[model samples]
Target chain A: MPKNTLGEHLRQQGMSRRSFLKFCSLLASGMALSPALVPRIAQALEATRRPSVIWLSFQECTGCTESLTRSHTPTVEGLIFDAISLDYHHTLQAASGHAAEAAREEAMKENFGQYILVVDGSIPLDNPGFSTIAGISNLDMLKETAKGAAAIVAVGTCAAFGGLPKANPNPTGAVPVSDIITDKPIINVSGCPPIPVVITGVLAHILTFGGLPELDDLGRPAAFYGQSIHDRCYRRPFYEKGLFAETFDDEGAKKGWCLYKLGCKGPVTFNACATTKWNEGTSFPIESGHGCIGCSEPDFWDFGGFYEALSRPTGQTGKNAVYGVAAGTAVGAAVWAMNRAKKEEAVRGHEKLTMDELNREGEES
Target chain B: MTSTEFLLWVKGTGFTLAIAVFAAGIVLRLAEIWSLGRKPDLAEAKGNANTAGVRTIFNRFIPDKGIWDRSAFIIIAAWFFHVGLFVVIFFFVPHILLIDSIIGLQWPGLPTPIVDAFAVITMVGLLAMLFHRITQPVKKYLSTFEDYLVWAVTFLPLLTGYLAYHRLLFSPDMLLAMHILSVELLLVLLPFTKLSHSFTFLLARWYNGAISGFRGVQS
Candidate 1:
């Protein structure tokens, strides 16, 4: 069972060493590492054993799985995904109820404290009956499975920040994997469904380094979530020129001016969508002439309307600003009136002085 | 605090405080100046005060021939400083955006590279102006602590902004916070100090022009 390493497996699959090295180089660059790190990454991945991965799905739409599966054709990313010893996945595995559960159990037992646990979607905590697998509640299953996991990959915004199910007044009382399991190193690949390359990139990083990648405040890999979308957007020049599309079909929009006035969240949202693109390097939301909805940010569902400008306050700040202005104006008026009275008094107290009197005053000084 | 938190504070609470102070101070200072109503000139008026006031606003921008020649370097450098400051403040996209957000009015901005060049020119011009102020005996004698305070506050925003744009000194968040905070410092000092000249200069020029033009002089 421990005989064939990744290098041997790649050779058996008829993948050339040159192609494998090229793949390593791509991964290295995608992860924001110098090209010099390619050889080290290649060596690390080559000598690595097939990491046992256990995938769990909870309250999700399965869009994340679709994003990965339909992300690209038979690319190296897919090949790497295939190379991992993925022991359990409900949609992908061909086993029935008991057989599937048995597969997960066997993999967990065999690779105890070593398997990578990948999760997509939030888990319902209010009611165990809300989401379950083979009559086992998702919460129970996650807690049980996480104990043996070396690390966890929270694959979608749902698993990372509880997504739509965990939006305001979350009915199912959904919570992210990190909320439930604090012991394991949770890597959040956050997006609406997350970028496929980012998912594969994080996996490659973990496989090569045998640890988690450097993360931002939200537990997202810093390499991918480092910069805001506006920084890399092609239409940024329009923003700098104060050219903006006020409406969706205005001349500014046609001219591809900045969508900032039309509720573009690109300025605030952090993601690689602008640089990486989607659908095999096709256009992203901003490119398609639509504004970003800030889907990657936590609780994006409640950041006011999707078409509301980001600088437009969400009610509270506006009222506060108004009050502040009123208070300031009132205080200013009072101060000005007092100062004016004092000046008038001083003016009234002034006495007329002729050249003779001024000369005498100066001489006394 | 982390750079991100520091940035949030600068953009949020710090910005709010700066705006409140600036608006209130400007209003108070303007009231003080306008309330000092000029004593009626008993002498016969030769020209219209309204036209003279308006004319003086633009006229004081130039000096009389002899004074212009005598202080040519000061005039040229002053022109550079004012023009450069105006362009950097009103024509830079970020500054324009800030103004638009606050006032609900928007205007086109100059190209980014032009604004960048003007920022550099403004910094150099300001430094040269400051050097002149300190090194020249007459100006140096008149200069006070407030002069240095205003200069430092004005210079910091430009320096920090350039550093932030090039991502030189610190992380992006930290640099951006420094830039915004420096601007806030300038704002807080604006109405209380000689920077109030931004407002008072107009009033003083108008008063001078009106008084002179009333006597049939093109001041």
Candidate 2:
């Protein structure tokens, strides 16, 4: 969504408050919060608290911020964080240079061990020379800022699992946030640039529950990453019946059958996309007629192509044909059925005729 | 009215419930697989195409070079039982009759002698499996009540099918009903049991074989 609110900007361009409130309700649900949480979310918006936040964008595309801003709220993006002040965001904050650096310093001291440190990309630790922000290396800035932060949220896959930058031949030696801060509790919300609602949902979870949701072995929240998308995918029924989409544009694909043969990793990749959805709960990559890229898992980028063969092809490529043996088996089975039927028919026919003859003899006598 | 119909209804129902019982058996088997065999951590490294686990196992499972290698006889026997059961169900006279009016196949069946022979052969093979399960020490250790239940459930259909066809020990009607009912019970139990593995075997086999394939080794 590119972090552009259709609010005052929308109002200036002409949008009604009624339409805006409806949009707010939509946003509330997008974050997967109960409708009851709406009033509190609204109240937080009406009485914006200005919670201090230090947004550190490292080796990233700024897509996370872009997604967050694109939320179709009634300026809810600005309003939600209005309760919490976003002290420094490289892309959003107008101020730069010594003034920008000065604001970060003051905010850190004021919210010491209390501020939310939102990190968007991986830190280059190989030489600390790979990525530098405002004269300080990303590695140094992260360490320094995280020293007394209340929470650290690794925003993108880069900061979550060292992402693409750490893929093969990774010269920069990028590392996820968990690798750096041993003392603090860090929430790694991974994705190429994770779904916008997931980002805010994590924030709301922290705000409402006062503790992180149960996490999986990979440290992803079990609420979202617990079940394999494949297990619950709508195409599962088709797979059970052996209906599969051989190609992206085929008839079976149009009918929404399984994409397993075309290398859909939904079978193994665990995520909420199938249920929670993307594009404002509109459609995810799989529903859009393309296979999942397994973007939610670590090292997904380096894992190779989306259409690459599955881990096992044992049953593919005529391996199951059983050829002479399979044909022989089928023929034998068919013959067996045929013979059983014929024998039963002949025996029953003979017995019926014999009984009739005996009855005839009894009648004549 | 036909031998195949009774077998289909028998097996269709039995194999189905066998699925549920099969599921439990698989979970129990997994417990043993975990304890008995060397298992690599599939979590850290996925069973992807480029990985060691999936690739190494694919060769043994996907190829046809070993169908009759004595050890392969067990698998061949398994296949025979499966094929025999399936043909008896789908291509059987009764099932055909049930759908014939709609699908319009109108195919004919084999004579009585051949049907009797197949019934006897199927029963024999099924007995061998039942015996093999009882005698194999490792399999015995892994066996559970559900496993025995599955074997019995599988065997009953074949027995009842033969009896129903022969009309040897009981009235065909009574024998046929018993056969059909037992098979139905098994079917209802399928999704909930290990017997479902009769179908899920492909998925599991593919999983293990794929892992081996990725590792560039035979399963």
Candidate 3:
């Protein structure tokens, strides 16, 4: 077994002690830990042996992997990947076919119940033929690989919430990892393509604390998904002030007004995109004059039209109102006719009697 | 279903159903009232009924000094509740967007914080009115189950909207769904209950003022 502490790996890569400490502090802050915990994180990560990470891709676009690897070199995410033993990855691994499968099998056996299993896409339960790696079905491979994992990391919205594949009229019957795996501690890092730092930040927390971080209601790390994107967005002031962009190039848009009027789902979406940002803290979707599509939330695709305002209905409400008016008018006219008939009946039934008739009736009695 | 899915349902199908019911009920009730035509006046006209009716619609917004002095608490609470409800509903950005979608009429909205303050005031005012109804002997005696039901339905939207805005008591999506659901309930119930006063009060005030004006008397 190859045994190397992360400290030794970093040192060999020419990362100085000061730089490593800085990285630790950065990681600590990103995880929302106090400054006081920096030393403990540094010590734990330095002394800890590299953990084996088996990356499994099933029914995914390579976007989540690209999100992590595409970061500028020497960034914290790249460094963390360098510090771990990545035994098998379809995209990044040098091995091919049998060799890659062999490496995965060996890693699972060598580090049984110790390796971290990172899943990037959803699992197809409909048919084994739908998604396969080396002729092994995604479901079969997942069930096999998940048996020995210390903890599972569902890396993107696909793996977390059965993203596009599980959208309306889902053909492949794709489902999230949690739908199948019920016995392990699964940490969901949900986004269309999760922010790179957030991906690394979660791994770092595990590396330093040797346990999963606090999770929110959806099994997402609370540190990143605790607050809503709208709450932390820089454009929040515009929302509060009621300045909204009516169109793509309107005055409000030019003035950096809130995109709420443009179908922004920021109010309902919870993610670190607004604060942690993308492209290395450069900008997120909302900052670029576009509304949030709520990529992080479950069933986002089926919620409604992406360009439709969150406050607006997805169906033909106007048509419904028109029909309602027609129906109401019909009912009203009928009721009116009935009431008029009743009144006319009462008038027709009215009887008049004179004092002479009453005197005659009294004499007869 | 997930909270997001629940939210979508309320915003979509549920909203459509509520608006349809509201529109139909209003039309039916109005038709029923208008069908009951008033008796024609045989006496000579002493005043212009049309002018008096239009004037009374605006004038009835404020009560006479005698009535105001006798029911100051009820008046103040009711006014605050009404004004607050109006501001929060029409001046809030999200609500404006909703209305604009339906009617194609857009308007600028007050700042969110200002609307939020109005929501709080609305809730407080509603609570005060409810308390008065329960505590005051005459009010308690006169009140029916419909009165309390209307009070609850009216107050729920304000409460839920406030909670959703602050993201309190539940997840953001869930709270927002609850808020929309509450509003939909109010719409569905409005036409059936005395809450129809929102529309009927106009006709009622006009009728009263027109009658008084026709007799050359102040109403």
Assess every candidate by TM-score: 0.75, 0.52, 0.93
How well docked is model 2, in DockQ terms?
Answer: 0.02
Q: lDDT per residue, candidate 1, A217-248, as tens digits?
A: 88999999988888899999887676888799
Native A-B interface contacts kept, per candidate: 0.14, 0.00, 0.81
Show the colliding residue pairs in model 1: none
Candidate number with greatest lDDT: 3
* Residues A314-342 of candidate 3: C-alpha lDDT, one tens digit per residue: 76878888888899899999998998999
**lDDT score, residue A113, model 3?**
95
Per residue, candidate 1 scores C-alpha lDDT tens digits across B38-130 of: 677999999887788888898778777999988888888888878988998898766765666676677877776788888898899888889
Among the candidates, what TM-score does chain A have in each? 0.85, 0.73, 0.91
TM-score of model 3 (first chain only): 0.91
Backbone clashes in candidate 3 total: 0
In candidate 3, which residue ranges exceed 4 Å CA deviation?
A11-16, A126-128, A354-356, A359-365, B39-47, B214-217
Ranking 1 against 2 by DockQ, winner: 1
Off by over 4 Å in 2: A1-28, A36-49, A72-75, A312-365, B1-219
Could you give the candidate ranking by TM-score, starting with the highest? 3, 1, 2
All candidates: DockQ: 0.34, 0.02, 0.80
